[model samples]
Target: MSVTIDITGLPQERIAFGPSPLAELGAALHALSEPGHHARLHGWTTTTAAGLKPELADRLHEADFMWRSTRSDILLPAQPRETLAEELDDLDRMDDERYVAAALEINCAGFYDRSGPSPLVDAAMRQRALDLAAARGPRQAAFVRRMLADPPGTRAWIRRLLEDCDEAFFADTWRRVHVQLATDARHKTELMRRKGLSGAVAAVSSALTLEEDAHGSRLVVDKLSDGRTTAQGSGVTFLPTAFGWPHLIALYAPGWQPVIQYPVSSGELAGVLPVETVKLRLEAVSHPLRMRLCRNLARASYTTSELADAYGITAPEVSRHLAVLKKAGLLSTRRRGRYVMHQLDVAAVARIGSDFLEAVLR
Candidate 1:
């Protein structure tokens, strides 16, 4: 069975910023702050009577050009400061177009050559595979069976099958089968339950199969105890065009909102800036108790009890706040005998400070 998914109702608004360039830059930078946000912000279009507005079209074109140009070779160093400082310096000196181009070039290069999938693509594919596995279970089983039966088929035939199959069918079926086989073959679920209920939940939730095409056979197991079908041979291949850009744009861009938005202030937008830095600075200084603790540690690293005594907080409260700061990457700890001494993570603090400054300046 062939299934086609039509995605519609994409956002058509032209990309517009506040009156000031600074405000615009801030919004754009903030949008890129979160993972995958840049792609969504830069990858949409509006069908206006005037044709594409020059500025909006230029921004979109630039984004794609940067993405493709750097996709093959960008590497982010372990320390973000080294890269971020250089990028910020470039932004300070260059024109908007040059700034955006350079920043995106570095971003794309770092991301593409990194050790993982692009955040946007990874989330999209995972959801797609899950939906496909759930919705067309039987059809997926049939497809797998056909593939196994004809390992040496022409690329054209394989492409036709992949394109024709409903988007939901294969993923839904694959997920169901993948889970059941994992449970039955490894008794993983049973073992997880013995560890704890949370473990059992995680085990059951770990659905979906990750297989290289070079594998000899891919098995589809039926949870209803119906049976199993294994696809044999060289495996199936899919064509790029089968995954159309329109469908992808629809999938990734669900709504038309800018990846980042800046709330306009009453005056001219020229002075608008990110308030995150101010917030962070206030957070760093606001609590007298936390400040005391920080001051004590600054003199020299100290155990929780030592700082707690100096600050007059209970041991538990001190531990709790320390845990929070540590998770924020503001603090680092080391065990010295029975005591865990706490100290600041300078690099993390610097990065947080720098990011705030950049956002505000933008």
Candidate 2:
């Protein structure tokens, strides 16, 4: 009935947590592109309707098999990779044999009921892309052909799909919302530090939840893959999701470290910014000078003098406004060599007036 991840054999020290850009990106892709998952993933449809051109929609609908109901193939985490480039780099590090094997594995109806290894694919490797291309569905076949001909290019295309959908669906919205997500992720990290490993894993979801059993730790997720998999010396990583709502995705390639992604707590993801924070954010744009400063930083990060020179204001005034926005968490600053650059939090303005999410749903 559920996939039991036996971590009893592994050390507690091996349990880890971090967010995966690939996992989140894959979930966003499915939520935005796949027709079969549209029911639970319903939120993305109206938001992406504008940017999803007719031709792209047709292609996505037809190529649904590549990102099928399970979506396990695309969720593989050979190692703990937090960025897109890092994940793809990890994929490339996989031997051709291992890569080919994991690429074809799927989660099936029988998988959940089995005591044995997954019944999705053979242990023996095959020419993965060619095999997928030979599938009965023309859409799947076409999609596989494209992947084979240009692997990097295909991944880039998929990335663009996620990015474009995020932009068009929300009207540059998710920025501020993401700050909440990041804040939640940080809180979870603090939980793990205080409560130990079990509490941390338990925090991810109640629906597709994680728990400890006599055998080891278990992750009960909403999917067909229902076989117990042992860490078998390879550890597991837990990642938090911000944009990836309503779905729990996992990576269980037979020979690799597993990664389970769960939705962050909604309580943390939503709710108004504190009244004071909201007031400060509003004030950040009220001044013609502050508004201009915020607008310039929106395009690119700037130093105090760089901003002052651009706006014909003095460095002192620029620094003062930047200080207020930074305190509001509406701007992020990072030190680069000798210069400290402030970047517009982008998530700043929508703290209140923009009901863009509500607009998308309508």
Candidate 3:
């Protein structure tokens, strides 16, 4: 429901603010996956739409499409880069081990499972695997199956997929709007300089549902579920975004810095949506995909990633679609271990359908 991040006694220098290429890469991928975001970023996406792998291109166009793997701490940098170029360079220099760690860390797609021998088999990594086991999807499973079968040669594919995504989707937008991001970072830095950490936070608090009192700052991101993470001296890094609007993402990696990313226009990120909500039934089944998904779930329940895989889309796409439908009262969802499952409200669907028919008949 909300995440309260503890930043007690965190030095001002520890809290750095800047734009990150890695963060934007995730946002750009998000833009491609979500229809609303696609609408906002149409100019950039259309240019590179042709270069993406055929299936990926089609998936991207699908209103329900989503990319799940990018939501990892390994993909984000612990330190702030002075410029987007520097951030990109930092991203490009990461070795395979780091990529593999991230891949294994959030293997909701089952890539590491069906493949050959894995370092993840180790006890420490094994626990991580169990934690993420519930979120695996067919597409990621298939990708891993293919990679393990091909091996050595296909290893490059992982990095290439990420690099291509960043180059195609985020590069142009970054170059065009990076100055604005710098301005944002400067504004926040100046706030901390003029006032204190609390002052800077208080200033930004006006833009978000964030609260700062005796217990540090609690950024109310309803999608985050009810959890709290201490700043731990890593200093909070605020990433201002353009396309990844409406969704507030709070990321904490036990040894890495805790990062809070919000849309540049975060007027009310929390005190609201939680990834699942209730709405006025009629508005729920309005969209074709939402209705289709509702019907699909009418027969059974499926996790967000599973639904995405079945529909040949991405997790975020399905997540966003489901969020609206849930809010509109068309569906209900639950979390089982790491997997979040959704079910169609059959009675409500029937009621709404009959209501529509009766109105038309009259």
Candidate 4:
């Protein structure tokens, strides 16, 4: 049901927190390419996209798989890597075996074990990698073939693309965001000190929860795929980023310490959300009935008719509340058959506090 990290015997200090410049850079590139999805960063993404060189833009498209969905651990370090320069150097100097394994694991799911040791790239392992890549399609197959033929060359190409991205826009973006990230990490560290591990882990994201049973304590993370990995005494690292909003990344790959990169609680850009925007959000949920609707929708999506029936109100009345929420961008709706189902935008609603602060200060 969830990805969990066993923390029964894990010590407090072993659980660490920090900012990862490489991860932030990767997320920023991903945001630039997919601007529609990350509406929150529209202003920054637009500016960054205009400045990107044609060649760098083409390469980002060419190796789109690197940052899409589950980002390749090759691009994202599995620990708290401090500086972009240092991380890039380490990635450039990575050995062939590890490079191939990490890159192949991106497209070839289940090619390696998370709990087991990192497999050596023997002849059989190479064959399996190729076969899995072939099943994924020509593009993936070609990438894997190139990796197999020359690991160093392939890694170099990937590194250069990242370096180009840094030169183009990410360096400036990093300078602006690193302070916010460091501040957030410190805030979470304080939460850990005051509330212990569970409180801090819960604060990272709404999707993560700390639980315990006969088997021992584990930090459960909501993810599309389900798997469990133990701390193994190495503990886990938590990294906060401004670009990776509405999504949380957890890496439990073999041969590296587990790391979870979460979005900052506050809006990415300070003083970006206007006062009018904050006013609209507050007015959307100000009504008692609308507030109730939001609470219910947060738990689960419901149709207008379903909500009306549950509340003993008319469908038209429910529709009015849904309309207000939708107008303020507080809800998302989809048509399921004849009924329109409405769900609250949890991330957008959660940003009210931060947005309010920015608006007030501005």
Model 2 lDDT tens row, 118-174: 212333222433442343245655655565455556556654554554454433434
TM-score of 4: 0.68
Name the lDDT value of residue 209 in candidate 1. 23
Candidate 3 displacement at residue 174 in angstroms: 1.7
CA lDDT for candidate 2: 0.53
Cα lDDT listed for each candidate? 0.30, 0.53, 0.55, 0.71
TM per prediction: 0.21, 0.54, 0.60, 0.68
lDDT of 1 by residue, 1-362 (tens): 01111112211111111122222222222232221222223332111212434554343332222222111011111111212234233334433322222223222221211233322334543333333222223443343233233423422343232222213133333333334333332343354336632343233222212222443322221111111222121111111111111111100011112111112111111122347753554476355555445433422345676555545678999987777666555577887545566865433443444332122221
Better of 2 and 4 by TM-score: 4
What's the C-alpha lDDT at position 315 in model 3? Answer: 91
- Per residue, candidate 3 scores C-alpha lDDT tens digits across 1-362 of 35566666676687777777667766777555433223445566565554677865644332111233235554456675755456656655665444444545444333321223343334544443443343444444454444334544444554455565556555666777678877887888898899866566665544335566775655454431334677765667887666555445666544446777756653211123333432466566666677556544653457886677656889999999988877777678787656677876644454454433111111
Worst 10 residues of 1 by lDDT: 243-252
Q: What are the runs in model 1 whose C-alpha is more than 4 Å off?
A: 1-285, 351-362
Query: Which run of 10 residues does model 3 get worst, by summed lDDT?
Result: 353-362
Best by TM-score: 4
Superposed Cα RMSD, model 3: 10.6
